[model samples]
Target: MSEEPTTPKELSVRSLTGLILSAGLAVVGLFILPVFRSFGLAFRPAFWLVLAIEAVALAGVVISVLTLHRQRTLD
Candidate 1:
């Protein structure tokens, strides 16, 4: 029996960027945010900081999806 060949598709740059941003933000937010709070940046400021990180990550994912769709359409 012959095995069928499978073609591998490369991930788009936007998608990779999204993944990196999401991961980096999560790591930084998890590790660094507490330190900032401990250093005296109390509730509201720290809350806003977390919100900003979440917004950026969400935007990255949205842009990545849009770019991927556009790229596929072009291909």
Candidate 2:
């Protein structure tokens, strides 16, 4: 049996979807953090900074997914 993905297009689509979901969840977390503060979760300025970093990471995942999708399409 081959180890490499035989259907790269499908893989790309799945990866893209996962990345989008991850990014969406991260965005939701960013918004919910403040709300959590009302429950004594402690919404510090550094937390916002961490959220910004998470957003960037999610963006990177999205970029990677797009790149993979494009490469699969070109193939």
Candidate 3:
């Protein structure tokens, strides 16, 4: 049997931190934004910020999943 000739790139500390932050932002957006909106006190900027954060979090999740799939395939 033959294995892959190269190793996959490891995620850097900064990159991992950013991913964790993104996931946190996603949780805030998923859980908090609605409550704010429900209270009817949130402004336009808050809404936009939450949306942007959620988008970034979603992107991070997609990238992470794809990377795991690639690594699995290599294995």
Residues 1-75 of candidate 2: C-alpha lDDT, one tens digit per residue: 868867544456666677777777777666676566766666586477557767776776777576655444553
| Span of 10 residues, lowest total lDDT, candidate 3 | 66-75
- Per-model tally of clashing residue pairs: 0, 0, 0
- Sorting all predicted structures by lDDT, with the top scorer first, yields 1, 3, 2
Q: Residues 15-69, candidate 3: write the lDDT tens digits.
A: 5666677678788787776776777756786688678878889898766655542
Candidate 2 deviant stretches above 4 angstroms: 1-11, 45-67, 70-75
After superposition on all C-alphas, the RMSD of every candidate to the true structure, in Å, is 4.9, 8.9, 6.2
TM-score of 2: 0.47
TM-score (all chains, Cα) for each model: 0.60, 0.47, 0.48
As for TM-score, the candidate ahead, 1 or 2, is: 1
By lDDT, the better pick of 1 and 2 is: 1
Candidates 1 and 3 compared by lDDT, better number: 1
For model 2, what is the error of residue 52's alpha carbon versus the real structure, in angstroms, after optimal superposition?
A: 8.5
* Reference-based lDDT, each prediction: 0.72, 0.66, 0.70
What tens-digit string does per-residue lDDT give for candidate 1 at 1-75?
A: 999975555568777777787767766765667876898999789878887887787787677766653322435
